[model samples]
Target: MLAAMPPSPSKPRNGGESHIRDRVRDRADACPGALRLHRADDGGLARLRLPTGVLTAHQVAVLAGAAERLGDGRLGVTSRGNLDLRGLPDDCGLALAELLGEAGLLPSAAHERVRNMVVSPLCGLDGRSHGDAQAWARELDALLCARTWTTALSGRFLFAVDDGRGDVAGLGGDVTLLAEPGGCALVRIGGLSWRVAAGDAPSAALAAAEAFLAVAREAGTGAWRVAELPDDRPLEAAVTECLAGAGVATSAASPGAVPVAAPPEPGVVGDRAVSVVAPLGRITAEQFRALAPGPGGEVRVTPWRGFVVAGLPGRAAAKERLAALDRAGFLTRPGSPWLTVSACTGRPGCGKALADVRADARPLDDAAVRGLPVHWSGCDRRCGHPQGDWVDVLATGDGTYGITVRTARRDNDDAQAQR
Candidate 1:
C-alpha cells in the first residue's frame, strides 16, 4: 500500500482530546528553497520544487551530480513531489543554484518556493484519467511565477492537480483541481468545492489562491492556509467572488462528487510506465543515475515519496527498466517491507532527533512488519508520518522507542490500535 502523507487537519492525540493548536501564525515560514537553504545538523539543506514532479533525465543527472559534488550523495524524496539535498556546505548555495539554473530546474527564483504542486503521476500515460492534470499544473505554475503576490504564500501551502482518476485529489492540497468526466473540473478549497470548465481550471485555482491571500489579509490572523483561517473568517464566499470576477463560471459541487482513489502502486503502471520507490525515500547517487531516463524521458515524483517513470516504449520495456531500478536497490515492486515503512532523518542530520530512526528502520526488512502503515519518527513532530491509522515508533532519548498506534477515526481507535 502507498503510505499516506500527514493529514492536513490535525488528528487528536493522547486519546482524542483534541491536540489542535492556535491556527494563527506568528512568524514567516522558514521553509527552505532552492535559493534559501535550511541549516540542518548535517549542513545546509536545499529543496528544489518540481512542479508536477516532472523532471528530465538530463535534469536528474544534473541533480545527482550536484548532490555528489555539493551535498550528500543521496537525494531525499519529500511527501510533496520535491527533492531535498542535505549535508551541504554553508557557502554552496550559490554553486547549487547555478547548477540547478543551468539544468533549467530554477525557472524563477522569486517564486521558487511557492511552486509547491502535486499532480497525478500516471495522468496521461495511462488511459485511466479523464484529462491531463499535468498540463493544468504547468499552466498554474506559470501563473504563480508571473504573480508577485503569490510569493507571500507559505511554502507549506500546496496545490494538487488530479486527473479524474482521483489519485492525487485526496492529498490535502490548499487548492485542488480534480478533473471530471464532463470536460469540467472540481476546484476545491478546504471543505468547499466548485465546478469549472476544464480549460479554465488552472486560472480558477490561481484565483482561489488569490482570494485566500485577500481573506487572510483581512482577518489579520497571519493565516498561511485556508484550514488555518479563523472560524468566523471562511474563504468560501471570497473564493466564489474571485471566480466570478475572473469570468470563470462555477457551480456548487456536491461533497460526493469528490474523487477518492489510492496512490499508484509500485509496478508497471498501465502499459507505458513504471512506478518505484527507494527504501525510506533515500536514493543514492548511483540509484539516482539509474532512474535517469533518456533524452526527453519524464520522471514524475509521487507525493507518497516515490518515483513514477512514464512514457516508456511499452510494458516489456517498462518492466526491463523496473528490473534495472530493482538491481540498483530500489523497491520496484510491492510486497517489500520497505514499501510500507518510512522514517525521518534522525540523530546526525536533525538536532532534535533522539536517535537514528533510519538506521533503526533499515533492519526491519527481515521483520514481519505487515498490516497497517508504520512511521518511525525522531520526535513529537512526526515530520513525514503517514496519514490515517499508523504504527507510531517514536524515539525515547534512550536506544529504545516509544510505540503507539494512531488512528484517524474515533470509532476505530480501540479496535485498530495494534500495539
Candidate 2:
C-alpha cells in the first residue's frame, strides 16, 4: 500500500508558509545561470533563461549541440520556460559562455540572472489576446538589460507579462504587467496596480524592479523576492513611491477578480498552431531540432513545460506535425500520463537527492498515479512541482517514501514504508 507523509526534512511545502526564511538571508543571491554555473553533485549545472521562452530553431540546435558536446545529452525544461544543462566539467564555463554568446542567447552578461521573465505563450499567435505580449516581453527584456541597476535584482525575482488572459498572472511574479482594454495595461507591484500605456509597460516593469531594490535597501534584510520582505514592511506604498520618482504615472487597479483561462493544452491553437507537451519536462537535442524545423523558425517555450509551435499552413498541417512529434515521444495528445509526473535531476545529477526519483516514477501501479499531477522529488526541495493542487511523492532517504496531496477537498501527508 502507498502512503503520504515524510519526515520534516523531506516535507512538502505548506503553501501558507514562507520558503524557510524567518529573517532576511543576509547574503547575495546564488541563483545559477549560464555564466554562473552551479556546483551540483553531478558537475557544473547551467540554467539559461529564454525570456518568454522564445527560441529560434537555430538557437535550439545550438543548445542541443552544446548539451551533447559540453555536458549531458539531455535538456531539462523548467516550469518557468527556461533550460538547464547538467553534468558539465568544471572548466566548461568559459566555453559554454562563448557558445551561448555566439548563438545570441546571452545579450547582457551583467543582467543574465535577473532576466527571469515569462510571457503568455499564445499572445501574438492565437490572436485572442488583447495585446502582443510577446513583443512586450522582448521589449521588457531589452530594457532590463540596458539598465545597469537592474542587475541588482535578485535572480529569484520574476516578471510576468500576461496578455489579459491571466494565464501567467498568478505565477507569483515580483512584478506583473497584465494587459488591459483599449490598448493599455495594468502594472501590478505587490497587490497594487498602476495603469500605463501599452508601450510604456517595459519601462514600468523596470520601475517596479527599482522599487523592489529601494525597499530592499531600506529593509537591509536581503529579501530576494517581494513576498519575502519582512511582515512589517509596506510593499504597495514603497513601490508606488518608486514609480512616482521614476516619473511613471499610475492609477490603482480595480479591486476584483481577474479572469485567467486555463493553460493551453496540446491541440491546434486557432487555425495554424499546435502545442506539444514534453514528456516529464525533458526533451532531447533531436526533439529540440524537430520543434524548430528550419533556420529562423521560432518556438515559444511555455511555463507549463510545453512548446507552442505556430505559423502552420493550416490545421491539418499543424495536426500532422503534432502526430509526428507524438510518434517521436513528445506528448501531443491531452491526458498523457507523462503530463502528470515531474522529477528533478536526481541521483547521479543531484548529490542532495536520496534516490533516482525519475526511475522510481515509472513503475508506480497505484490508481493515484494518474489521478493528479504528481511530482517525484529526490529530496525535500521539490524543485519543479506543479504550482497548484497536486500530489507529492517524496523519497525518504532511509528506504521509504512519503506521499502528500493538497487539494481543495483534502490536505494530508502520510508516511510509506517499503514492503
Candidate 3:
C-alpha cells in the first residue's frame, strides 16, 4: 500500500537521503509486500505481513506452495511477526498477489503493505491475558484496509494491539492499544498512552493513524515514518485532538511494563505448544513445509523471530522434531549460542555492506558474548537491535567493526571497542 514519495529538491544532501536513494536505485529496494516484490541481490523478496500473527491453516499452506513454486522455497519469519519469501523469479509479483488474495491473505491491494500489525502471540492462549485482542486486531485491520487514504501511509507504519501484558506495545508502535479490564483499553501513539473505552479501540486507532498522516503532511518534512517527523508535530497531542473530534473520551496512562522475555528458549510452554527458533530468522523451504501442522493445528510466529506449533499430538513427537531442528543447527535449547546473536545479511545481499558480517559473526559463540544482547551489522544501518537495550557491533567500510555496549563497564573498558 505504501508509495514512494518523489525526492525533494530543496532538501539538504544528508547521508540519510543518499542511503535511501541508493537503496531505491539499486534493485528497487522497496520494502517487500505480497503485491510489490523487492529485488534483493539474490532475487525478488516478498514480505507477507501477517496482521495479528494469525493465519488459517489453508492460508499457510498456500504460502508454502507459493514459496516452493515461485520462490526459492525458503521462508523467513521476520521480527515483525511477518513472513518473507526470497529468490523469487521476475514477473511473479502479480501472480503471487493473486494467489495470496485468493487465500484472503491480501485483503486490500492498496493497504497490503501498510497492514503491519502485531498482537501478543499468547493473547487467547495465555490465561493471564486481560481479554482476547484478536478480535480488536481484526477490526482495526479491516478498518485500515477499507480506507483509501491509508495507502499514503508508509510501509513501516506499525500498529500493535497488546492484550494487557504490554508485550507488543513495548516494541514502539506508531499506534498501540493495550487491553484493560472493565471493557476499556489504553491507546498510545508515539510513546503516549490514553485510556479509552474498549468499544472505541478500533476507531481510536484509526483516528491516531489519520492524525499521524495529518502531522506528516503539515510538517512538509517528507518523512515517511512517525519517528522521523519533526519535533513540532507531536504525535500524541495530534492523536488526542483527533480522538476528541471523533467524540471519544480519553485519559493519559503512562507506558506500562513491557516484558523482556526472550523468545521462548526452546522449551515446552504447556502441554499443547512447542517452541522452535530459526537461527538468524531463516528457515529452509523443506523445513517450512515439513513444520506445517495438520488440520486443527496451527503455527504462531513470534515477533522475537521464532515460531510455535500449537496443539501438537504429543510431547514425544514435538521433542523429536525439536531435536531434529537442533541437529540442523537451529536453536531449540535454552541458552543456545544462536539465541544471543543476530546479524543482517552482509556482503553478498547488500551492496552497501562493507563485509560479510554474518559469515564473520557466525564463529563467535554466544556463550562468549556476555553482558548484553549483541547485534552485528554490515553498516551503520543497524536494522534490528533488541527493542529494549543491547550491544551494537557496527561494521566499517574498511572491514573493521565497532562495538557499543549498552551496559556500564569497568574503568579500563571502552564503549566503542574496535575489532
Best by lDDT: 1
Off by more than 4 A, model 2: 1-22, 231-233, 362-371, 407-419
Q: Which stretches of candidate 1 lie over 4 Å from their true place?
A: 1-23, 362-369, 409-419
Model 3 per-residue lDDT tens digits across residues 359-403: 877425444456366778898767665665567788987778887
Give lDDT tens digits, candidate 2, residues 133-191: 88888998998898898888888899999999899886767888898889888887655
lDDT of 3 at 109: 83
- Residue 223's C-alpha lDDT in candidate 2? 76
TM-score sort, best first: 1, 2, 3
How do all models score by TM-score?
A: 0.89, 0.87, 0.82
RMSD, candidate 2, Å: 8.5
Write the residue-wise lDDT of candidate 1 on 92-128 in tens digits. 9889989999999988999999999989888887688
Task: Please report how far candidate 2 places residue 60 from its true position, in Å.
Answer: 1.4
Q: Count of backbone clashes for each model?
A: 0, 5, 1
Which is superior by lDDT, 2 or 3? 2
What 10-residue stretch in candidate 1 is worst by lDDT? 1-10
Reference-based lDDT, each prediction? 0.81, 0.77, 0.71
Question: Which model is ahead, 1 or 3, in terms of lDDT?
Answer: 1
